[model samples]
Target chain A: MASMTMIPADCSSSTAATTRLLPMSCHKGKALHFSRWVSLSNRLTASSFPSLSFKARASSPLISAKIVIENAAKVIDGKEVAKQIRKEIAVEISRMKDAIGVVPGLAVILVGDRKDSATYVCNKKKACEAVGINSFEVHVPENSTEQELLDSISKFNEDPSVHGILVQLPLPSHMNEEKILNAVGIEKDVDGFHPLNIGRLAMRGREPLFVPCTPKGCIELLHRYGIEIKGKRAVVIGRSNIVGMPAALLLQREDATVTIVHSRTKNPEDIIKQADIVISAVGQANMVRGSWLKPGAVVIDVGINPVEDAESPRGYRLIGDVCYEEAIEVASAVTPVPGGVGPMTIAMLLSNTLSSAKRVHNFR
Target chain B: MASMTMIPADCSSSTAATTRLLPMSCHKGKALHFSRWVSLSNRLTASSFPSLSFKARASSPLISAKIVIENAAKVIDGKEVAKQIRKEIAVEISRMKDAIGVVPGLAVILVGDRKDSATYVCNKKKACEAVGINSFEVHVPENSTEQELLDSISKFNEDPSVHGILVQLPLPSHMNEEKILNAVGIEKDVDGFHPLNIGRLAMRGREPLFVPCTPKGCIELLHRYGIEIKGKRAVVIGRSNIVGMPAALLLQREDATVTIVHSRTKNPEDIIKQADIVISAVGQANMVRGSWLKPGAVVIDVGINPVEDAESPRGYRLIGDVCYEEAIEVASAVTPVPGGVGPMTIAMLLSNTLSSAKRVHNFR
Candidate 1:
């Protein structure tokens, strides 16, 4: 384990002042509330690394020697794990084909001409092909009517070959997203964005027909790594419906004491510091610093923010929510920015598709 | 405000022993966990009031004199609150009828002949009449096939006048409950048991068409009492589909830092003692005691367990999960068993019916 360093008190003073300004009152014995507030206040005071003076000490021989003393945290290797899962899915697909003469099929409905949306659809199509699952694609013009999109969904809904349906998000501004998403048959909702699937996920004792892909991937990573979630404290930062909210519910279902830290959370760092597992989906680049983490905590960073990099040919570099250099020292293990969570999303989508096909065909 | 009494430490030793025997570890600071454990351990240790020498004290005038020093807690007066809400609902019903010439209609489908189920249906019918809403009832025989029940639901689903539909729970052992519940149109699901409604409730920005009655009633009581939920620490006991799970999700929606303690949770008392507000829906009688509460915590007890009381003609009395007599001394305000959440459930059902009618009619 790498040695943990404590940030200076001066670096955290502003945050302490802001927290004090917030309207929160601790009633009763100051013993419990007072000590807790003090500890949280200490952890949240600094916004960035206190030892960031390394920028000025870059040329110094003494500073360079100090960095050699620390050991790096083990990388989570999400890309490798995702590949292994894809292989397993491939085996299942081949077995289903042999037994029932059926191939798992996924239909992707792309409404607009956004570059990112096109890229995502292409990736999903390729992923389906890689695992021997049939892929169907429907592209509507940017100026297409809502009815046109719904018509495509209806066609997919009635198709016996299509086991799963995914409607790319952020449908044109003129269309109601909920209406379009809800139009997809619940049985074929592979993305699991349908309200019914989300409700089942939140509920206890009721199993959702499909779990949301991204959050499912996060849990799958932890499971594959042999991490024990039962009875542990897990914190999910950011409560976006697609990732954070479902992730928290999934953790709770696994018997972990889960807490969600969103924009309204008074002392997010304090609440986050107590977690045995931390999963951050907030898109802010490098928002989580080493000081915010508990020693030896496992971190899964879902944010993939692009920062300007003049040296790169693309003139940009993608980084996660956690400050990688700092977190590597503080955490026991962590998922790398580009390789982590990204690949797992597609793998989960494939997995949901496979499960849907098995259910439809009554194939084990 | 009631003058609190401190119970003897010896009374709570057994519960403390059980809690200690459970596996729990606070990695860093044991002091915080220890203090919290002490407080919860103190409450759980005592099976009953420490001064249960009441039989012997009745004959002694000096012992009776000591009782005068203690004060009683403020009663929540749920009956009065329920009455007030009914009056408001009645006014709205009359106003809507006068303007639009249409009254809100609620349809209830009850299966089997369980005495308790019959009584609940009767209460719901009476509540609808009290608020001048139309009441429709469908009683299916105990051994009716699933298709027969589905046919009845389809009839109600097509009825334009029916604004809300509630299928009384605990269908025959042979019937599939989820299939029957899902058959009710989401727009008319007043019970809010549908996965879509639950999904909407769990998500951050989505609005549930109807909040689940019991959990909605609990939140309403807190709102009526001017209890602040945002940023407060809340602990919900149990994870039942109907109450505990939804209650925790509702609390989180209200921005309270929520933790759910279920059967699998270790050291539940230690986790619960830190809550500024506690909502317990576990069916166990007297599961939560005075010591488990924070000194000024507000408690909402949803459990209605029946215990034998030979003096009564009915041979039984209803009690809440909390040991009421002890809780009144520890908590700032507490809801009574028969009057507390029971009346609120029907009130919320009426509220949901009215809202559904207004939504369908496009009336404010």
Candidate 2:
């Protein structure tokens, strides 16, 4: 295993610090040598990495090579893992269809003209088709009443063909999100936003009918990678109901001692440094730095934050809550921003749909 | 303020370590000095207290004076607090009754003839009568069917006079606890064991109809004492559904950075040392020692474990999960075992009943 060594190089500019990596050994028949210019303002205190010192080497203008050995973190390819899951789901669906003459169905209800929501819904429909699951769609105008949306959910609840029902979020501000989400029958709540489902998830000895997709996807990645969770220290950044809170609960359920760091938390970096596993879902671009991680810690980044990018066609590029460049050198394993937890959300939704159908039909 | 100083004294016996306290300045015109014999086996490492060294002083047989200054933690008298709360609740109930001509009523169903359960039920009834709230009781044999219990719950659910219904736990092995708990109306779930209530408690911006009594009491003690919770580090030392789990959720809801330490947690003392507040619900007697706490931490001990005491009329006496003798010298404030969380549980139950009546009748 070839390791990368980071050496702090004296920089002429005071605002920026440069770190140079000298060629050491070959990995995959390729020599590595590079220099990185990091802004001093964004540099987190190196308290977590006590062995490595990045203090200014302004006294020595020449090569002041300080060997800071770093191991390249194994990249958790969510796209590939999600594809594997989809294939497994397809096999189950085909088998169930042959035995019971039934296929899982997912219903998507969209009430607004938002472009992003439309794109997400479209992708979900295509994913369903690829996995041999039937897809149902209903689009209502933004001016539609809450009663109309509730009626749609009620109709879907009565329809046995639709195993799962998901209403696109960020509904019209006038609509009561809780009321509308609660209206979805718990059995068909694939999105799993209902209070009853969440309650079950929080209670010990009780199982939720459906786990929320994003957090469930995060845990699935850990399991698929064969990471041990029991008796390990895990820290979850952000406490949003959708991702962070449920993710912490899931980790605790798996017997990992869990701590939740939120906006109100003080010295979060110190807490993050102690975790054997870290899951960040704060939706902040590159908020977690390499210095905040414990060496060999597994990191699951659920954030998909967009940063302004002049080179991109859309003038913006997506990044995770973790600084990828720094994390690759420190963590034992990490999930990439766009291709990591993002793809797994939809995949888990489909899995929930399939499970719901099987449960309803008493299929193994 | 008078401070206590602990000095390690050489003991003749190798198995036991003795700590002697020299007389310091008077507090309330009373001089305090004492010697305590602590078992070496139960001694936790003094890593949290770097300043204090408890290493064996076997070399010196006489008094080797090493003054370790310790602040005496204020004793939180739960019986007094509960009494004050009962008075406040009584005033509210009288005002509501005069304004709307309606009184709150609590109905309790006891399934078995367990002596402890009988005492608890009788105490609850007397508490309700003392506060001018109507109390209803149902006693059933151990051989009673689950349907019979469900029928009692159903009757209480439809009764306008009954604002809250409680089913004593540890029902006969034949009964399903979850089903019976779920049967209680959400609005009247004064015990707050219903998953829906717990789910609401876990979620942000959503309030449960009633918070679980014991955990609610713990938070109340903090609030009543004017202890700040926001942005503070809090540690909960268990994850039982009844107390520890709900306590952690409640602490998080109040914006305290929360960490849960369970049996699977490694080096629990290290984690507990970082908390500004600690709540321990594990039933093991004296599991948390002074060395496990950070100086000035506020501790709430919820365990009521019975230990042998030959001097008492009863062969056993109750103690808390924390080592009270050690905690009183280290913590800023602490709740005693019997006089602390025990009284607050019943008080919160009564409070929940009153709140239910006010909510159902639309009486502010």
Candidate 3:
């Protein structure tokens, strides 16, 4: 097992300088290195930890994913389980298409390109195609006005082909993210990232048409892995509304005691050690080390960061916030980064798109 | 300290359930409970808890209203604080009346024949008169049609002076809460318990004009007490959207490592013992005990339950989920049942009403 070259010391996540600018150093120790982990847009942070996802120690075959996959088979099979879900969605989409002549359509709008957003969009498009749904894409320049972006949203809002509309996040800074995202009509909000959908998702009794993709992916991973969410001590390390917030809510809804830790939380690593399930959504790569994970805890890493990797042809590879090397040895079961939440997110987006199409086309 | 009685012997609210429920409990618990709570309009289940509020405990010194009141002096004198707020609203109302011949009016529609609802309506009316705001009450028979209720909401929605309209909750068993609540136009939804308000409350960069009164009242108390919410480990017990859900969101917005525990949560009592601050909104009398609270954590008890009390002339006394008798001895600060959150709830409702009027008239 290649010992995770990534250590806890690798990341001195920059201090959170925004907002109230709270100093939580009193929480752990007073080594006050401000973390610039927060960015104007990008959240993807870990690249070097990419290979660690499947094989923890490059030298230790005992901790490799092949064994973890065999152990997890007694509980869940992610690939087969995901296949079953996609199949159900496909059947549903076909049923909707035959009934209303409406192939559930998902229009993904990508504005100004980040590589990660491009990859996500491409995967979403491919997922739609795989599920027998229509996929539409509109690539607008990075300097697009809020009005222009809204106009595009309006077009999708009116397009009967568009059952679910998703705009790849981290939109160019000049574009107001809130304004553009909110413009996607609630009925067509497949990403489930819109406030309206989020509100419905957060509230009781009201069901959201679309649950946010990442959290949805996390839950699907747990379900297929047979990781029980009810009555568990689950700690989510992140506070972004799109992932951490909804993930906490979803966990709570299942009757788990959910704690959301962020840059402001006191002794975050200590808090993570208490969880029976630890979900690290913070974008800082390798922030959640093996010591932070409770032994035998289920680990779901939602981060996909690009770290400098000279050995790779692309010069960088993706990794999760969790240090996979340490986590696999300590965790009873864990989801590997690229093949873990990544695929599940795209799958859920497709499912949401099909669900939205079914709702709009009135196909029961 | 009094020993806390466990609900279900098999419920390891301390560990087993906590592990299994951390993910699904929060999102599902509240909605399911809200649905069950509101569905009584359709049918009553023996399983549902009583609607007895926390205010009735005012007469019991064991509940320690004065002690909470005493400690709260640094932050607020509720009586004085509430009086000052009312005075501000009165002055605003008088100014509006003289300048525009407009006074803020609140219309409350009471459905069915619940004496408690009648008493609550009476208290509200008195509060309105005390604040110089016009109060209108409409009592309807238990068998009122859904359309009739919708029509009333529509009428209030269009009414000019009636800036805020609240249909008393726990509406008749025959009404669909979502439909009925949604009918109360978002602008006039002063209670802030509406799904839209809950959603807006949940999101960042989006603030709801009116936060649900009880949760907002809790925040007001903390704010008045000069308690810093940012970067705290705050645990919210119960998952009701009206109180717990909104409270957690508000706390998180302030950057708390927020955790929500409920019926299915494993070892919830143990989970809560880790909080720096605990807000219990589970509506169970004395569910949160001193042992469950961190030594000096601030305790905000939102439960207002009626328990059999022979000493009281009413034959019942109201108690909060936190055993005030024990919490005060352990917690550095805590809210008592009667005077603590009770006065604040109505106070906030009045404040919200004025806020809605101000928003409508651009008074601020």
Residue B189 displacement (Å), model 1: 1.4
TM-score (0 to 1) of chain B, per candidate?
0.82, 0.84, 0.78
Q: What local lDDT does model 1 show for residue B159?
A: 96
Q: Give the alpha carbon lDDT tens digit for every residue of A20-41 in model 2.
A: 3333242111111110111111
DockQ scores for all predicted structures? 0.46, 0.67, 0.54
Q: What are the per-residue Cα lDDT tens digits for candidate 1 across B57-159? A: 2445554434311322344556556777888899999999999998999999999998778889999999999999999999999989999999999998999
Measured on C-alpha atoms, candidate 1 has an lDDT of: 0.77
CA lDDT, candidate 1, residue B156: 88
Of the candidates shown, which would achieve the greatest TM-score relative to the real structure?
2
Per-residue accuracy of model 2 over B1-364 as CA lDDT, tens digit each:
0111221212212223435342324221111121011111122222322222234222253433322333355566666678778988999999999999999999999998887888899999999999989999999789988999899999999999999999988788898988989999998999999998988888887888999999999998787666778999999999988899999999999999999999999999999999889999987777788778887788999988776667679766777878776665567777887878899999999999999999999999
lDDT (CA) for every model shown? 0.77, 0.80, 0.71
Stretches off by above 4 angstroms in model 3 are A1-84, A98-100, A113-116, B1-80, B95-101
lDDT value, candidate 3, whole model: 0.71
Ranking by lDDT: 2, 1, 3
Pairs of residues clashing in candidate 2: none
Question: What is the Å distance of residue A174 in model 1 from its true position?
Answer: 2.5
